[model samples]
Target chain A: MVKLINADEAVSLFKSGQSLMIGGFLSCGTPDMVIDRLVQTALKDFTLIANDTTTPDCNRGKLISAHKIKKAIVTHIGTNPETIAQMNNGEIEVDLVPQGTLAERIRAGGAGLGGILTPVGVGTDAAQNKEIIRIDDRDYLLEKPLKADIALIYATYGDAYGNLAYDGTTRNFNVLMPLAADTTIVEVENFSDTPLDPNQVIVPGIFVDYMIVRNKHG
Target chain B: MDKDKIQEIIARRVAREFHDRDVITLGIGLPTKSIQYIPHDIQVNILSENGIFGVGSYQTEENYDPHIINAGGVGVTIKAGGCFIDSFMSFSMIRGGHIDVTVLGALQVDQEGNLANWCIPGKFTPGMGGAMDLVVGTKKLIIAMEHTAKGAPKILKKCTLPLTVAQKVNMIVTEKGVFEVTPQGLCLREISPYSSLEDIKQTTEADFITDLK
Candidate 1:
């Protein structure tokens, strides 16, 4: 059974050298509290699957600027100049997936689907010796699904049963990230005691393993 | 016009569209330039997909943190009382409708207002980035683009390519004019004196008409 905890206790679950599927494309839809909690832990050498690493003072970006992460699978590194600096300096390993491909790969990971083929990143430096699958006699690049040891997710609202409701704009990565990891942690605002309406539940309760109620500290 | 000149035309259009106190997200190219020209007193809070909301082009050198980026993933700085967040948290803000307006770049805008930002035929394509989500999720969408690309009118009667977001554009600002998509078709609200409806039609693929006075 999943345990219910506050932001601090829930985030403590992360450890050094863990593969983390942190949800969000760019900066939207991150589990802020869990990220905040990770800060307190000083966990290092973590592998992150996300869209961007961000800058030092960027709310969630500090993790990268502070050197808390080891590797990342992402689309672009435009915002985190330091991250780019690290990459250019060969201090960081970056696997730049096309944005849509990255999201589809995450979804495939969660759905337990094998890698799919896409035209994204094709004919570019990004398309290295990855498998090229042929569909309808046309060549498409094979992209692999990405799985992680842990998943950190954010939501606008949640019920005690772990149903999630994400607000717009921030809904980028939350929908698929929960299932790609062994353990899924949700940080949410306004936890409700009543069961969430089935019609509105974006992330089902079954995929969630832990719930962290967002508080003032978050 | 050259790319820079075209962008300037788009810049002025976007700067004029700023709503006071609005929380805004600007996409790549001209959409991002709105920040550089806005009146300083507008008090619009800016959000970037890469994760900074309180920012602009004129950030101090000391404040050049790389993680702080705008919707285009370009590095930026934050204003006072601003907080840096994980990219995931930033997406949550967008998914949750926390942003009031989003300015997207358009490769092709169909008559029904669907957008195609990725995969241009015979031309190179870029990542869809966050456009698919922004078009579907943001409360309002404003597209900024050249009136045509390589002399081909991208304002289409219907999307001929894969769609990034379905029927989400509310307003469009191009080098040639400003248009609002309505039930009838593209409504030309503002047109450059040098251009006309027929001129737009020569390049536009959609059925468009001058708005009723």
Candidate 2:
């Protein structure tokens, strides 16, 4: 069973300089209430692994604007001007990975695989500092698995057991982040009184550690 | 030509590349505009890297769902029978060579079919989103863009910017002309009605083999 907590208690689980995998594609599936609460906290210097930092006034970008993120491992940052500015000013370090490669690396981490071999970045700058292996005369860059101390995800519906169901494209990184982290906290919009049907559950209860039932106004 | 007309020319030309039931992925910006030009009779499955497999047209204000968005973060409608996927599954379909064609706007394309569109070093360093994966995995890679940038040729002998992928581009549809990238080099296939052979020759820095009518 997963314990249901408030947003304030969720904020207390973090420490400085921790690596967090945030689930979202430019704020669509982001844990808004948790992120909002985290922004008010004194925590800083977090390493964020997400698809994008989003915009300045939105979700993960708020963490960047608050100067809480020391480094970001993401696929895109063009939508967030603050992240670009921070990267340029040396305030935050950004490692730009290909979106597909980023997803596969997280999957590899959760699945306990060594790493992934991909031909996507073979001839590009993304291959820099990475090991290359050749098979059948084709070169592939070896991207290592990425694990995080915590994962912050969002779900449209969650049961007491923490079985979650995401809506639409909001399931982007949310499905993968929970598996790649030691502690997975989901900010749920609607809580069901009964256990959710197994057919409807996108994320099983075993992967979820905690749940934050959002306030009515939040 | 006017900016709208230039975009129309490129979009219309790129739209002709699609066939019925072809699974295509369109990059953000001008490539997305090509959706409007796709033939009505031909139904294609649009892939959005954000996790939807059968992406439909853009949504209006009334039908806008914040959760239903394309890779560019714009609200969009999903086609009938479209299914939602996770990031891992979405990329698996992309990197696994299931996508038939991918149309992307480019900053530079060299004669040797090298594509440079992701970064400009210090000026523009937006990360390579899924372009590197799409270009290598798609069955056909098409580049849709203007012929020049502020009168400067984007088609060059060598790409000054970093490459998204090397020697992967199959076709290029520009406002001025259509080009096929071959092992021998760039071959000009069709010239746009608004532009002449001399105009293309003058605006392009890369040498191309063409017998345009």
Candidate 3:
């Protein structure tokens, strides 16, 4: 069984200067209630790993706007002007990885792999300071896996066993994030008393540490 | 020319490049506009790196669903055969050479076929979303942009900005003309009726071989 907590308790698990893997692609599958609670906290200097920082007033962008993130390892920050401003001002460190590389790195981290060699970033600035390995006369950049202290994810439905099911494009990063963190916490929009259908279970119960049900007041 | 006219010309020209059954991905901004100009009879499957395949037209307020969005974060609808995918599978399709063609907007393209669109160092450092992966893996890579930037040539002998992918651009479509990137050099394949060869030469910084009369 998975431990069910409130939004406050969920945010309480976060610490200042810890790394977080947020599941979302521009706020589509993001944990809104948990992020809302996190925004009200005094936690600062967090390292955020996600796809993008959404818009200025949305999802992870709220953290960027609130000056909570010290470093952001993301694929794109073009949608969030606050992130861009912070990066330009040197207020925060931004490590921009290619989207595919970012996904593969997270997948590698989750799968217990040391790293992946990809041809995506080869011969570009992304290959800078990275090891170039050659096989079959083709060069590939050795990209290291990326793991986080905690994973904050959202799902359309979850059961007492923590089996998660996502909807539509919202499943983008949510499916890969749960296995890539030390503690995986999910904010479920709907809770099922019984176990979810085995076929519909995207992330199994073993990977989830806790879950918070979305309430009307939350 | 005005912005709308430039977009129309480039978009219309780029739409002609597509064939039926082509699985294509369009980058944000002007490249997305090409969908409106695709031939009515041709059927192309669209892919969005946000984990959607067979993407269709954008959704209106009445049909808007927050759960469905394109790579640009705009609400969109899916085609009949469309299906959703996870991020890992989406990138797998992109990096594993399944996509047919990719149309992208660029800040700069050069005679050497190097593309620079993702960053500008201290100025515009919006990360390379999936461009690096798309350019390297796609069967065809087409860059669609204006002929010049504020009266300065965007097509150059060599890209001054950081490259998105080195020597990977296959074709370039501009309001002025269409140029194909070959091992020999940039070749002016076709010139728009509105622009003269001299006009192209005056606005372009890169040397090109053209048979336009």
Candidate 4:
């Protein structure tokens, strides 16, 4: 069953320098409250796996603004001006991944797959001799998977059963990441007592460890 | 050289053949023009990965509001009965291959259906953003670009540069022609009357064969 907790307690699970996977694409599906709690925590030396930190004050971007992230293995960071500033100033290290490959790596991490094959950035720096595999005498790139100690995700709603439903874009990372992390926490708009319909839960209860409640529509 | 020509090309390509009720994703930059081309009566769902589905008209600037944004990180308009959700899940839709047709712009297209729209001459273009995910995950993909930039061909025999995605370019629509890449080779379907085979070949040193359709 899921339990509700305050933002501070939820964010406390994350410590500085820890390898974390923060789920959300941009603003949608972001664990804003958890990220907000981290703003004042003054943590650093963290390795982050994300698509992009949410917009300032919206999602995990608050963490970036607070200088909490030391490095990011992500697809894009253009929206987070602070992230850009930190990277340009050498305060943070950014490993840009192909969007699909990054998602696959996360999925692989969850599924116990060590690596995957792809055709993104084969001749570019994105493939700096990581590994080259050939099929039909044509080249494809081998990409390694990534995992996290903790994964924080957002969903539209959940039940006491810990089933997850993403409202919109918020489902981006929430769908596949819970299984990829050692611990996955959910922040849902509505937390109810009724068990969700089996088909309605974007994420099943088995992968979730905790749930936080919020009112998104109200 | 003419605004009318650019608009015509942009319009025709955006409304390409596809399932009538599939979900569509549009990339940023020139590909943005595609929004203007979609027919109003079409029932297809136009989604902005930022967070909005059932996105509305792009022509009326008044229709755009700050709260409605697409995955490209730009403001957009939402249609009636639209619901705003979170963007994190929007990306989940992409990662899970829920997208139907994803149209994007390219910098270079090589003989083997590869694309290099993110960088050139060692200078970075806006990195891969959501493109790799959209291309690999979308059911089908298309690339649109100017035939050449600065009089040099953007299409080449081999992308002698960094690429955003490889072998993901299923079709190429330049101002000059519409070409479909297949197991056979670069097969041409249309060419602007103003340009010739020599004109395209002269733009880049890529090998070419004519399959005029």
| Residue A67 in model 4: lDDT | 81
Per-model TM against the reference: 0.58, 0.98, 0.98, 0.77
Model 2, A167-216: lDDT tens digits are: 88999999898999999999988898799989999999899999988784
Fnat of each prediction, in sequence: 0.08, 0.85, 0.83, 0.38
Off by over 4 Å in 1: A216-218, B1-27, B31-213
lDDT of 3 by residue, B1-213 (tens): 689999999999999989999989999999999999999999999999998999988899899889989999888999998899988898889889998889999999999899999998888888999889888889999999999999999999999999999988999999999999988899999999879899999999999999543
Output the better candidate (1/4) by DockQ. 4
User: Which regions of candidate 2 fall more than 4 Å away from where they truly are?
Assistant: A216-218, B211-213
Model 2 chain B lowest lDDT segment of ten: B204-213
Comparing 1 with 4 on lDDT, the higher-scoring candidate is: 4
* Clashes (candidate 1): 44
Candidate 4 predicts chain B with a TM-score of: 0.84
DockQ, prediction 1:
0.08
What is candidate 3's CAPRI-style docking category based on DockQ?
high
Question: Taking the tens digit of each residue's C-alpha lDDT, what string does model 4 give over B1-213?
Answer: 685676468547756644577788877766667666666666677767656767765525755443345676555566787665443455567656788888888778887888776655333433576676677667777787777777787778888777766777777777777777778777776677767776666774566567887
Query: A47-155, model 3: which lDDT tens digit per residue?
Result: 9999999998998999999999999999999888899999988999999999999999999999999999999888789999999999899899999999999999989
Give each prediction's root-mean-square deviation over alpha carbons.
Answer: 10.8, 1.2, 1.3, 4.8
Candidate 2 - CAPRI tier? high
Superior by TM-score: candidate 1 or candidate 4: 4
Candidate 2 docking DockQ: 0.88
Ranking by DockQ: 2, 3, 4, 1
Per-model tally of clashing residue pairs = 44, 0, 0, 25
lDDT of 2 at A137: 98
